[model samples]
Target chain A: MKKMLAGYDAVAEAVKACDPDVIPAYPITPQTDIVERISEMIADGELTSEYVRVDSEFNAASTAIGASAAGARIFTATCSQGLKLMSEPIFSASGMRLPLVLGIANRSLSAPLSIWGDHTDTFAERDGGMIQFYAEDVQEAMDNIALAYRVAEDKDILLPALSCLDGFILTHVQEKVDTFTQREMKEFLPERDPVHTLDPSNPTTMGAYARPEHWTETRYEVQRAVKRSKDKIGEAVEEFADVFGREYGLEHNGLLETYRTEDADVIIVALGSVCGTIRYVIDEYREKGEKVGLVKPRVYRPFPAEELNKVLGDAEAIAVMEKDVSLGYQGGLAIDLKSALYSNGSRIPVLNYIVGLAGRDVTKDVIKKVVEETKEMRGKDPSDIGLEEEERWEPLREELLPGDKDD
Target chain B: MKQIRIHGRGGQGSVTMASMLAKAAFETGKESQGFPSFGVERLGAPIEAFVRIDNKKITDRSQVYNPDIVIVQDSSLLKLVDVEKGLKEGGMIIVNSSEGPGDLDLETDAEIVTVNATDIAMKHLGRPIMNTALCGAFAKATGLVDRESMARVIKETFEGEIGEKNVKAMSEAYEVC
Candidate 1:
């Protein structure tokens, strides 16, 4: 039945259908609804799962690790600070080669303690050895949950996976979502026959300490497994498209989704929910007879280098918009895009435009401006064009009060 | 295609209102999408939710700029956010306040429809959360979704006692607004 489902509820329902044996979560804004729904589903007997309400995000991840290692399909969700707290176990989940799936609501890292939409929290774990797939909207968020499980459980690529969505941007959005029935989900996602499990029947040693003599090779083998996971991700997305009438290309569709960029001279590259805005802006510009397009990267972890280089081969200028800052460096997505193009020996001028952080709105007009700026920078010197500027930032509040307005 | 933006706070149910409106539109056999933009992660911080309804499926997923209708769940958001920034000329502005349409202290070229949804909600539901009541007012003003479809969705969403009170609140809001 067609139901109006909020993004978070859709995810929770998909998780329930997947029938994960263990669920460990810590409550965080934007992501709280997902965990709360899951917990309630378990409590109401709608879902029969080991609902582990952990004291902290770290414990949440640890619990998932232990459960997965003990041969159960495990699930967890976190955002911003919660993700940071779970960083150590995230790496452990990867290192131990546990086939775990995590629903990550991407939020800004704290200091100022902003619980808004941003890539800082996810980008911080870039080196955590987990494969990451970003969903553009609520539908993808639900689809990716199922796909992540399938890809992670592939024996040849037994590694953890993360399905990341813009914290409140996509998570809290209510949209028409088609939930899969158990029969449909079973057909879409292969049942788990874990490569390694804490089977008391088998009596195997797990996560045993490797001495320095053999530790280096063990680390190398883990690296090899991660590299192999890229291929598995592509295959899984392809299989999902075939089964569900949706194609998330691995080598081609998996890496990037280019919209109206074939004949366009200016292309804007972005990820996550902002890609949706860029697509809207591109349509508007196209209506005005401007050759503007958008290239959205779907896979952020393995860094879709080959696909991006090919898609951007003909573009005159590429504008990269990132929600997370790289501090002294270019924005995270910008840096990755630059590296991808650099390896191809392409001298295409790539401009970095950072917009929409802390839940700031990225409207179509802002995207149009970025395209206009990229066109204006066509003949200008790279040194003359400054990527970092205050004007690029979207204004959060129209009126700033000097005193308290609460009275 | 028509887009609508709802402005409120974190716990104020702007997202819920957006979803209900979309559901109402869907029940009428139209394609609709609703989403929210938020960050404060706290109770009272300002938040915004958007809805797009069309005869055809909406492929564009962007914030509703040049909205055909604007629904303000809180009047205070007017001073904080540019609520009328991209309002279409002659579009409708439905605010949940005690003030009349022209009573609002703002400049707008659109048709304004104001309802004291807070009073209606409190009178019926005994709470100040005006999302569902404002949604009823929005439906009455814009006619984007029929009141009957909205009531059905509301009944299905809320349970037992709360559902009865919210239905009363919505009916009162529709009558006055």
Candidate 2:
């Protein structure tokens, strides 16, 4: 359907089209609408699913675990505090190898009580054993809902997947989204296959406690599958392209979306809706004869180390702009990117800019300045205090971020 | 791209107005996007919402620091915030007020157009949800969106008498503008 749908409603509609067997919903800010819309669908008899509203996110996630173990295809959504409240169960869902999908509207965690958009929620879950796909906008969120199922429920990759999107920024924003019919959704993503589910006749032991002797191997198994899930992600994206006629870095390890980076001397790496702003700045600079480009890493987990090397190796310098931080350290994404580059033998000088935390707006002007700063820091050791003070640029951009007085 | 910002109190349908404008633009086969500020504050707080429409797809997700058009669903918002921040030169300002251009107390090179949207909405919609009515004036003052598309979206949004009444209020203000 050609329609204007908010990312919030779009995810809900996509979930409806997929027709999951069970949805255990618990409402939270920014993500509450997805649940509300799904509840409305169930109420209208438009969808026939066991829609259960639990008391909290923890309960919702726990219910998903119970449902999935009972051979039901489960789905749920949460953000920020809700995600933290249910973190343990999230890891458990993946460990149990349940082919479930969790829709995440990424939001800021709070000591200050903010209900705004940020990646702090999902970034905190980087090691939750669940495969993660970060969507850029309304269209991506809707499409990835269906894609998440295809990747999650693959026979070789019976792992839980989270389709993460920036809260409020993308969730509440309305844009023209092309929605698919149930027939099309079925063609793209079929009903979940219960490969190793709880069966009454053929009873199997599941979620049993592992002693010290076997705990290592059990975790290694999940870690190994987490790494191997990339191939499954690539295959799902390839099949999706073949059927839906839209491509999303399927050839590039289904990892990074390299935009105008082919001939650029400088590039900024970013994620989510902020990439939308970064692309605009890159275009503006390009019009003025600046060789600026952007590489948006869509898959944060299974961090695209090799792809980053190949795509960003030729750049003069690179900046990793992120909305989530590690507090005493640099941003989570920037640190991961630096590690990715180092491991891949790419000697590029990487700069980290922490931006848009707690729903702060990263405007075109902000991104443009970041590109300029990265260009100036080219070929220099960012760790050298003398070089940093000479140009007066903080590698972490402490001055440019929000919630601080001076900048 | 034509950028439009709507300034109003929280419950005055500021974000809804922005969404309808973008949706109407989409219905007319233009690429459009709409968003409210990240602050989901209390009901009476002054807030800003934005809509961007273009011949080609828009990629910028930044807030509209400058807009070609400004629609004031509640004229009181003009005093609370910088309603004219970054308006392009010779921009258009549409206000929901009984006062004429000389009495609006707004300083800008924008062509000032005022419609008593509250009066129109109260008459036709039986309440002061002046967003739809302002869209009507927005159509007449700027012609960014046609009145028919605005009515179609409004009707599609609301159901039964409410939808008919919203369309009626919007259409009446369109002729009045």
Candidate 3:
């Protein structure tokens, strides 16, 4: 049913519809609202899940791992410092092949503390063996909760998954979301039947120590599993469309959704909530007869390289806009985009724009500037575009930073 | 899309005002969105919230830089914030104050309307909170949302005796405004 709901509340509703057996999560900004709603649902007798109150995010993930090992479907959430604290157990969860859903209200990491939204926390754990899905808005965020659980619990793809929503941008924003009924959700995602479980009477070793002989093979198996989960992700997305009757990834695969890219020359690639602003800007440019389009990555972990190339191959230039920077390198999406496209043998001029860090507003002006800069790279040598010594900080205030360059 | 920005103290329910306005608009068959400022809010500190209403899906997630309407729940925020900043030329401002528009001395081409929401709230709800009263004034002044829908949303949000009292304050403020 369609209801006006906050992003967090919507995700919590989705979680309730999925009805996990156990929920072990600690409170953190942005993410706090989601867990709070679940707590209320459990308290009001609307849900019967075992809500585990943990001391920290570390215990949250550890408890999730233990519960999932005992054949209980699990759900938990955290962000930024909380995610950093939970990283160790998260990796362990993946290595142990425990399938559970982890909700991440994507927030910026801190030396200088900030409680705002960004993708730094999610990208920091890119190496961790878990599936990642980035949502564009509240509806997608809600849908992805079910999708993540569906894909995670597949007997073939028994890996932890993250349903990431931008902190305040989507988490706090209120919008109309169409949530599924529990009956529909149960049809789409049935109760988990684990391939392996921890029974005290007949205890079997899981995530055991790997020696030199077994270490390489075991890690390779995880790598292979993640690689194989891409198809499972696609299948789940298709099934979701059949059940919910909403095609999240229309005309394109569920991995990378393309917006108005049929004949566009400059296509901006983005993840999460910024895609909405880019779509607005694209409409503005379209009014002026500029063929601008957008490609939003719904699935980030399997990286959607081949699917992205199919839609982006004909574009004159590509601009990658992201909320997190890799510090010494370009934004994570840009780095991944370049590598992905290059491997596909498409040497398109790709412009990397680092924007909206720590909840800084990425307005239409920033997106327009990206398009203008990307337009300049249409026929230029790819090597000549980013020749400047320093990274390009779009919409940067030179006066505030102690920089010599005067604009 | 019609954009709106609300300014108030942290404890005064500015965010709640934004969300309620959006919900009212949604009740009237319009798509709406509401979100709070990125600032870390503390009680009594100034904070801002935004609302957008349209016929179609509201996709632009950027903070409202140009609002067609601005609502000031705490008139004291005038000294600290440019509540009129980026207001459209022919837009409107609904402020919670007993003073006339000329006395507020805000430098803007937009029209300013005042409702003594504090007095109305104190009379009906026995509190100084002006969110419900200001929302009533906002509905009466702009006509973007009807009083009936606003009252329904207000009642849906705050139940029992408190809801009826807020609706009373709202109706009184609406009458005066």
Top candidate on TM-score is 3
Candidate closest to the true structure, highest lDDT? 3
RMSD of 2: 2.8
Show where candidate 2 strays beyond 4 Å.
A381-407
Q: Which portions of model 3 show Cα errors greater than 4 Å?
A: A386-391, A403-407
Identify the candidate with maximal DockQ: 3
From the highest lDDT down, the ranking of the candidates is: 3, 2, 1
- Which has the higher lDDT value, candidate number 1 or candidate number 2? 2
DockQ of each: 0.49, 0.84, 0.85
lDDT of 3: 0.90
Order of candidate numbers by DockQ, starting with the best: 3, 2, 1
Candidate 1: list runs displaced more than 4 Å. A250-253, A377-407, B7-15, B35-50, B56-66, B72-86, B95-108, B114-133, B161-165, B168-177
Candidate 1 positional error at B153, Å? 0.9
Each model's chain A TM-score: 0.92, 0.93, 0.97
Candidate 1 per-residue lDDT over residues A148-235, each given as its tens digit:
8987887877778888988877887776777788887888786788877787788887667889998888678777877776777777
lDDT of 2 by residue, A179-248 (tens): 8787777788877777777888989978778899988887888888888878877887787787777778
Q: Per-residue alpha-carbon lDDT of model 3 for A79-160, expressed as tens digits?
A: 9999999999889888889997989999989978899988999999999988999999999999999999998999988999
Clash pairs for candidate 2: none
Residues B19-93 of candidate 2: C-alpha lDDT, one tens digit per residue: 999998888788999998878667898988899999987778778888999888888878888878888998988
Candidate 2 local Cα displacement, residue A295, angstroms: 0.6
